[model samples]
Target: MNLRIFGWSYAVTAASLVVALLYGGWEALILCAVLGILEVSLSFDNAVVNATVLERMSEFWQKIFLTIGILIAVFGMRLVFPLLIVGITADLNPVEAVTLALERRPEDDPTSYAYLLNEAYPQIAAFGGMFLLMLFLDWVFTEREHTWLSWVERPLARIGQLNRISVVIAIVALVLLATFLADEPTVVLIAGSLGLITYLAVNGLGDFFEQAGQKQLEAFEEEDAAGPRNGSGPSQLAKATGKAGFFLFLYLEVLDAAFSFDGVIGAFAITTDPIIIALGLGLIGAMFVRSLTVFLVRKGTLADYVYLEHGAHWAIGALAAILLVGIGYHVNEVVTGLVGVAFILSALASSILRNRRLAAQGVETRKTADELAADHTSV
Candidate 1:
């Protein structure tokens, strides 16, 4: 991987370190670096999934995703999002919440922002877990000719033929999680249901708009006879228009938020310092993720490693289960990160092996054709 591809991420790192040093000397800077690394480690799967959605968008929208979307990921989800959680859970105003975060230290202050955020973990876990569960279910159930985990995925795909099965599975998972695995069942139920609903809304909107766009494109094709205009570019944005573009952007942001949920909460484990968490995880970490997404899209890594997406969703499924389990217990962040990495690496290896097999088959087929042609020529 060329370091130049991640130039923006490098800049973010330098800036974050400077801010950390200004905020709290060497100690803060070190902590910031650690948290930033942690976020990147934990969110590799997120980058893969983001790239998958991002590559489908047009060049203009891709720029928007890198710029505007980064701001939302870094500041909106990373910083303000935690505060919103604290404010709502603790019944404090925005100013008060900010004060609570700044003034209180997790080590000494029982009423610190970190503590409040931890207290609200049940709901956070419920919502994030359910949302991720739905994503995982959808990926598994959606029929595909190519599969990474053929044995498991094939069965799931078969079951997915039943209408709304993904939703049904998610609902059942939420209920089971709430009834047996959550500390506060009512809160879990409510949050998990909201997560499910949010996923459905975002996904449904994207599908509806995509269908509309397809119809429009079809009509345009019919009228023109030369085919839908490719314009001056060959990008997903060029292919998208109006509602489709808007909905795709919305879908990406919502998906980013859902993915960020765990990272935000997980940051608390490293340090309860809101500033450090935001600078490290939100700014530097998220910037790297966005950069990684762009890198993957530009390099066509997804096309090369077809099974990588499959591995990512499997990792997501594991993470979802871990989140639900975390509602009643503290799961180590390192373990969580490792599980995701393991799945991703495994998928990559599988893709390589499959490629080798296909290449071998092609070579053998060519050799057989050559022998047949030689025999015919000799006769």
Candidate 2:
């Protein structure tokens, strides 16, 4: 793992910490630091999943993801998103919302920006929860070559063979949530439905383009085997490009937005100051995910650690459940972080075991990863 990719992230983290200390006091700095740590625990799974999608993208789009994606994560989701939400929920215009966000601190007043954002938490939770749920459910249903927790995963995959199974389960979950858990059931229904629709549209198109990209690669590989054409080869055609790359990029952004919902809302629990939230949750968190994504792609972490993706998707499923449940009840950030980390660490441990098992069995395909997994042990 080259540390070079994180150069920009470190620069941003240091710059933000300096800004936090200068802008507020030690209190703000402390809160900012805490949020940064929390965001890593909260979003580490996000980096894993992002790497899975990102590896399918072309180099050009991958560059765009690291550059433009960070800007959107910081400025768009972390900053403007809160302001925009406050504006819509509070019935304040854009300027008024910005003024209120900047001027007012977190007070006991019902009119404060934080108060308004908290009030609208359910809608945000509903939308983001359903979107992430769809992502998790889609993976859950798909029959895969590899799996973790095979006892549970194997059963789910068997049942998932039913057509439209994931969608059915998701809709049923929505109906139950709206019926039993919501204060305003209609709002939950609409928001949740929109989330489901967005997932279908985005994920569906991304898969379509991915298949197309695969076909293109196959064709290029065939041409290369026969004779070289232009300067293209398997390496050049390896990634998804054109429309395929575009949709993959879009899917990643939406996925990041969904992941940030809980973090954004939870940050208010730490500090009502938008600037601190932006600096901590937005800047630092974005840096971690971005750098991790690049690292995973470069190092082939997913291939080496077979169960990491499974662990990440499981964490995502758990998070989706937490968000939906949070609609009516308080969900602790500690619980959320612990759940994600547990899955990730457990999956990592399982991957090591599986690598050893395969190595002991003398599986030819497992040669490379097994070597990386346990270098001391002879094959």
Candidate 3:
């Protein structure tokens, strides 16, 4: 509740809105504000997932995530990525893509540049949807002592005992999505497969480095125990560093990209002006999300609210479902966003009730350092 962390986000929002007004006139300003709300409704759970991973990083890397990572999230995903997609899909060079985007508006004409850009939606949905599905599957399948939606999650976790079941389920879902409903079935299948591969590579690499860091921590601890000991153990020891930190950082970017896939496409419905979209969604919405993520980490919110992370993954799962379904049909953006919000809010309410019940019973629920720390000799 300090509110100080969001100072930079507020400044950027003002500046971005001012640019929207001056360049785009009052209508642009209005759309900018509208897009901010849209982006938030679409991506707040993205921030929560980010916090779970980012809280483990060193302070220096955390700064890198905010600075360099913001640039990637804003410009890389919001701007360059769209352009890149158009270029590849339309077989246009980069300059031609930029020229087309500058010349034509989709809101007005059927054969406009924006039309070409919008045509790439199915591929985008496939890639982002599969990636997120993998993330949700892995999390739910991994057995954990604590769970928020036990009836649902516990059953999924039990199924996880079958090795690589998450991958199997994801593949089945992808096949169903592509073969049954998608217009460009082959293209969506390839895109979704790439998404699955990307998730496996990044998650596998991050986990490997995380285990190495944990081993290093364990070595330090054993050394500490052999010699003179402080009453406290090495509580401050880093769970992830060096390569582990880099891979985790990479994972965060992929997660952001996946989360933004639909949000970026959804912005087209409001305006085809890429600049305004970046300013509204990237500069304003994403900036606030990053700040909120840091706030959650610094405040120890996740540790206190045990169900929050579970809620986020559940929201992610819902978002993935929406994206996959959207390939065959147009799903309302509000519906997509609200499904995520509902899951998160319900999870938060459950966490509060659980906390109160534990307090009355003289029981505790805060995650032990080890529980939160797994992934390194576990963060």
Q: Which of the two candidates, 1 or 2, achieves a greater TM-score against the reference?
A: 2
- Candidate 3 regions exceeding 4 Å error are 108-110, 223-240, 374-379
What's the residue-level lDDT of 293 in candidate 1? Answer: 92
lDDT, candidate 1, 206-312, per-residue tens: 66766666666676667568655655433443354655556677877877787777788888877888899999999889999988898888887777777887888
Model 3 clashing residue pairs (backbone)? 214-376, 214-377, 373-378, 373-379
What are the candidates' C-alpha RMSDs?
7.8, 5.0, 3.6
Arrange candidates, best TM-score first. 3, 2, 1
> Could you tell me the TM-score of candidate 3?
0.93
lDDT of each: 0.81, 0.85, 0.85
Error of 1 at 125 (Å): 1.0
For candidate 1, the 10 contiguous residues with the lowest summed lDDT are 370-379
* Poorly placed runs, candidate 1 (over 4 Å): 107-109, 226-240, 363-379
